[model samples]
Target chain A: MLKILRKEIKAFLKDRRAVMLTFLMPTILITVFALAFGSGGGDDVHKIALLVCDQDKSEITKSTINDIDSVKMIEVIPCAYDTAIDLIKKGKRTSVLIFRKGFSDSVKNLHPLPLDFKYDAARVQETGILQSILPKALFSGTVGKLITKEYFGEKLNMLDSATRYKVFAALAFGGALSDNNGKDISPEKIMRVNSTSIIAAQVGNIGLVQAVAGTAVMMLLFSLTGMGGGLLDEKEQGTLKRLLYSPVHPSQILLGKMAASIIVAIFQLSIMFIFASLVFHLHIADKILPLTILIFATAVACSGFGVFLATLARSRSQLQGMSTLIILSMSVIGGSMVPIFLMPQWMQNVSVVSINYWSIQGFYDILWRQLPIGPLFLTKVGILLAIGITLTLIAFRFFRKNVMALE
Target chain B: MIEVKNIQKSYGEIKAVKGISFSIHTGECYGLLGPNGAGKSTTINMLSTLFPPDTGEITINGLNVKTSIEEIKKILGVVPQEIALYSNFTAWENMMFWGGLHSINKTDLTKKAEELLQLVGLSDRKDEKIKGYSGGMKRRINLACALLHTPKILLLDEPTVGVDPQSRNMIFELIEQLNKDGLTIIYTTHYMEEAERLCDRIGIIDSGVILAQGTLDELKRHSEIKDVIVVECSQTPDEAYLISKLNLNVKVTDHTVYIESNDSKKDLTRCVIGCSEAGYEIHHIDIQKANLENVFLKLTGKQLRD
Candidate 1:
């Protein structure tokens, strides 16, 4: 038994790929997770730039902006309303806070504050973060004391005795009367936040959109690479040599693998979207044509990436280890695992090179931005197709010089 | 016809094929007989255009391998030593895939796949996945895959390795039939019997060189070792006694004595009389003719299997 154990151990140790993967996978995963988590909520690491158009320019709006900036996670950038709008439209900015033109008279006289919050619909996570923080920044501390005095001291005193008692009872009861227990206490009315999604105005649920697109993009890459590993499997089985023996160019074989992977990826993406639509009520019918094109381009890029990685590795196990490490790293940095806004600036910059980033971005344009098939949308698709073509060309060269040599 | 002229291949410092040349007439089954690592597969790989030789040239049907590899591929089918197949795919599916690679149309591919599977005697089990196939079954499918294109030339590299006797015979019969149908063949095997049974002419190769090439009779005629006469005695005798009595080249192992003779009939009479006069009871006498094994032994100084 000990002899067998020693032999098995020696065999396992001899397989350098397996040994490297055994230790490397966990180490890399832990490092990636650490980087994402460390930068995810840290104030210094991931600072969300909040574009502010101080149209009011009042003492109160200025103070409100100052309060928002005081929060460690937000960086306040003051720009003109039109500039902020342009930035948001171009996807350079996630959210923009606008203090609409109003005299300081409203806050002094205890009237409703005029404010408008506009954000990119695709950056739904950023929207939620701003929503939670903006209210606290607006209503907390000195601002909250003044608003509470006017909101309750003036309005409640004006109510009739019986109505006031009923209102107080409902507020104290805290069940089924949370909304009706008070007058004009809803978040929208309190902040006068006419929140508008400058892009994809019709998109209802951005969470489900991101979930579908992000998971689909990441999963598509995983499956495509797995399929690409078939190339190495063929080499091992000697079928690749047989194929080379036939009257087919080497590029044709690589292209055939890419084409198969693309077909499978498209089917996988379509099925996932269909399931998302059925189960999660994701709206797909209106944008089906653009979505299909985006899916096709994404598939092409991912399949190319898969084939390229296949050519890089000498065997199937090596491909598996290398692809898993690469795809997971790409997923994390590319905003599939973590929202791009939550990642460090450097990681976001690095993500532009990953296939997952382009794929997810293309899906976002179709589903979240709802941008028509215009220059912006086509550019994303074009980049994906270009990446696919470039990787495929490189893979072809490698296949000819290395794989066909059969050394 | 195929002409290999002074072809040499090297993998870094290891010279696999060192400036070897041979010619094959159309429809001739030429065997490359060698032990493992004797460059047989390397030569076949070069012939199949899997890789190019480091120097010299190969021309098939008057077309140079360097410029006409694509054209050559259309006419060449290679059955490698390893069973080159997709185990997850059925035998039928594997044939269709290879057929597709050969640019065969779907209609013809279907017809050819059916025909080849039938020829391989696996038509009934064509739908079963190859992962579950026995070694012999996979070997049959491996051969069948190569024939899907109906090429003019076939290269069989140790195709019968690890196969049972029944399947080996089946493969031999299939190869014979294909050759008879005017398909030129290049067969590489370490098994002398396989080469003797299949090859019209044989090339004995070892250590990256062709030691000799000829017909079986011619190879035997050229061997250094002559006919062997064996005299098995009832009791063991010392070598000195046999050598002193016979005064011939005799080797004694246990109770048997082997005598090399130019004339076996004359030597056998002298050996029997010598053994009897030396008080050694001759139990049996047999004469063995020069065979390919002996020829290989005389040339390489090692057994064929070694």
Candidate 2:
């Protein structure tokens, strides 16, 4: 076994790419993702400026301005139709509302409606807000028309008292709203908050961040299984046999191979964590040490699992195939690809046994939420450590049973 | 220093090495000679303690392979047919690590690895990756890796099989020198010439059985023919048919022909008479004794190529 292990280490040294894949590549990716894509605080909200053009100077047009700015949620600026259109086309403003000529006169006369509003069809958000406020603005315009027709009934053209009474009612309300300028009350408003629970702003969804980072880290660790191929390559060359001709048992070979893989995994995880903290602004809070320990244990177990896989595999290609199936399954079930909590309830039930789930979950608890590390968290850590140890033992035993023929 | 009595190994229904027995005395270069697929490797693998034979009682320097694999491993060096050295590593690095496997102390390992590298005529290329080395250079490094621990017995399985003549000669010389230094060597090869030149005692094994085992001279003495007659001819010549027409005791190849018999003079006189009647051209003939190929043919009644 010692013979096989030495040969495996030498083989790994021969493949510089394997070493890089094992350690450096992960470090580079983690750092790049964390630093380049990292943004702290809540995600940036979309900003839009709404511009209004009143080509017609009328009470109906003025009420439209009031309706647009009534919510005070968006900034509304009054400008010429051409200026507003150019600003919107240039993206200086996201939307422009234009009220054409004869809008107020046509509404007051109560003949065929002559009001027209033009807006950018491409501005989805602005268009939606504008659509919601259209009814309020039109109602306000109608009230202005009713007032003018009723107060000036004898001075103008009105035939029935029923219509006269209706005009009086409209004038009574419109007179108050008109003198107050274009500031009118809107019947519609938007509300955008729904949360069953809320955490502090400093954390900034730490659990989700950890889940994504941890998944990447664990999947990258699977490449260490290439060390098994190193073993098979040596055996083919007869270097393996030369090693086995020594006074060493096969267990020693497994131990050495596992050692190299674990070291690589450790380096990989540390790189990700450091990059996450320094570049991505991932908060470790007071649980940095515990998270580091958790990552270390995960690496150890996974590397041992890699060696065991190498032992069972007949060839390098076979080992790769097996490693893919095994590592991916663990990651998927463990919440490396998807957070275990987000998975279906049945899948979550399955994740309790997954190595990735435990490793990723532990990291999230330690780094993101900054919750206390009491006995419950301690038990989860214990389970992870136990799993790592068990895999090592089984893998070592497998090497002992089969490595005799390596020579 | 190696002995086997009734060793048998099988893979499922296929019998790889069937009830074979042989021995290699201390300081003796023993050869296991056979054609391809004759189970020479199966026999050697068992002797190396790589895996135990299914039915066997074997001893290496008084240590049984089945019961004392650890002891057997300590006293033997193995060079497999394939070049096992890592091309990515320097020749010296390969040797050092292999030596380390035997628990050789770090200080001793460095000195020993350097010596083996130098011996293989690769002292200058010791630090270069074996990947760039020629086939012969890699073979030399392979031998170097095996010798790192300086095992008393060397089990080399066709170490010079695919090398050029120069490299093959170098390997043979190295093996001879190692034997001179009191190393017991068990060399296996399909090349009969290698066995003839390198082995002190040769075992002709075919079909998992030893057909003959003795010194070269002793085995040659068993051949009835003392001389071979040569009849050089063109590759397209109908020599076999012409010889059969004459009813002469003769065998013809594209390059030469052999007329083997105790009465060479009488046979030649009859051959001239028969050839004259057939009107076939007569080529000069000189008789000579049989070599290993002929001896194999005489014993098996089948060509070695066949």
Which candidate ranks first by TM-score, i.e. highest?
1
DockQ of each: 0.67, 0.37
Highest lDDT against the true fold, candidate: 1
Q: What pairs collide in candidate 1?
A: none
Model 2: what is its DockQ?
Answer: 0.37
lDDT of 1 at B284: 89
Model 1 chain B lowest lDDT segment of ten: B217-226
Candidates' C-alpha lDDT: 0.83, 0.65
DockQ-based CAPRI category assigned to the predicted complex of candidate 1: medium
Mark the regions of model 1 whose C-alpha exceeds 4 Å error after superposition: A1-15, A40-45, A56-67, A101-114, A135-194, A200-204, B104-119, B217-223, B233-248, B251-256, B262-282
Interface RMSD of each: 1.1, 2.6
Clashes of 1: 0
User: Residue by residue across A1-407, what tens digits does model 2's lDDT show?
Assistant: 99999999999989865776677656654543332223212352222345677778777667656765664444468888778766544323445655557656645554433333444333333555544444344344454435345334454343244343333323322222222221232101110101111112233454446455556556654766776557777666666666665676766766777778778888887777677677776766566678767767777767766776776776676676567656666665665765443333345566667677667756654554343566545666788777767877887666555444542
Give chain A TM for each model in order: 0.82, 0.50
Model 1 residue A302 CA deviation in Å: 1.4
